[model samples]
Target: SFMVRPFSLGLRLFVAMTAGHILLKVLAGFVVNAGSAGLGVGLLVGIPSFGLMVGISALELLVAGIQAYVFALLTSLYLNDAVNLH
Candidate 1:
């Protein structure tokens, strides 16, 4: 259980971070492709893609912080348990 808990936490964090990055990369590709498609299409697709990228970036930051906090809290709890073992 001890090893499984941290492993699951790490896997969740890894997936969250990787998914956000992959999404941003795909959105960036859309923006670049839209640019070559001309101004109208660029405005139509690029703007929304850019906006979504920004929003996702912000969300990624929040998720990273929250995950880090959770990881630290769990680590401390484990340490406490080991130290106070009777």
Candidate 2:
């Protein structure tokens, strides 16, 4: 149980980070495509897409920190559980 807990925790963090990065990449591609369409089209679609990417990037940064903290906290908690169990 103890070993499985940590494995699962790491897996969850990995999945979350991977998914966030993938979404960011997709959004970035949209921004690039929109910008290349033409000046007028670029201004309309690219501006909003770029803004959304900025917001998502900020959120991802926050999530990354939070995930680190959570992983550390969970590790400590698991350690505590192991110590107390014995």
Candidate 3:
């Protein structure tokens, strides 16, 4: 029950991590730009810049966790669907 499919889990985790990292960068850019101009978003200057990097890192970690959990859950669910019958 604790074992994960090596190749599948690896691939799933890789995909999640890559996608999450890219999304974080794109979203952070918006925050950075907004901080420079919009809504006197300049108010975000002091900490938002630092916050953006921290957010990206946090998101990557979240994605890693999600990938592991989702992959394992789905693998088990699939196995159950295929093998366990009422």
Best-fitting candidate, measured by lDDT?
2
TM-score of candidate 1 to 2 decimals: 0.84
Task: TM-score each candidate.
Answer: 0.84, 0.87, 0.46
For candidate 2, write residues 1-86 as lDDT tens digits.
98899889989999999988998898888889987899998888888888988998999999999999999999999999999997
**How displaced is residue 32 in candidate 2, in Å?**
1.1
- TM-score winner between candidates 1 and 2: 2
Stronger candidate by lDDT (1 vs 3): 1
Better of 1 and 3 by TM-score: 1
Clashing pairs counted in every model: 0, 0, 0
Local distance difference test scores for all models: 0.89, 0.91, 0.69
**What's the residue-level lDDT of 19 in candidate 3?**
81
Error of 1 at 41 (Å): 1.0
Worst 10 residues of 3 by lDDT: 1-10
RMSD of each: 1.8, 1.4, 6.7
Clashing pairs in 3: none
Query: How would you encode candidate 1's per-residue C-alpha lDDT over 1-86 as one tens digit per residue?
Result: 66677677778889988999999999999999999999998999999999999999999899989988988998788778767875
Worst 10 residues of 1 by lDDT: 1-10
The runs of at least 3 residues in candidate 3 whose Cα sits more than 4 Å from the true structure, single-residue gaps closed, are 1-15, 24-47
Q: How far in Å is the alpha carbon of 48 misplaced in model 1?
A: 1.1
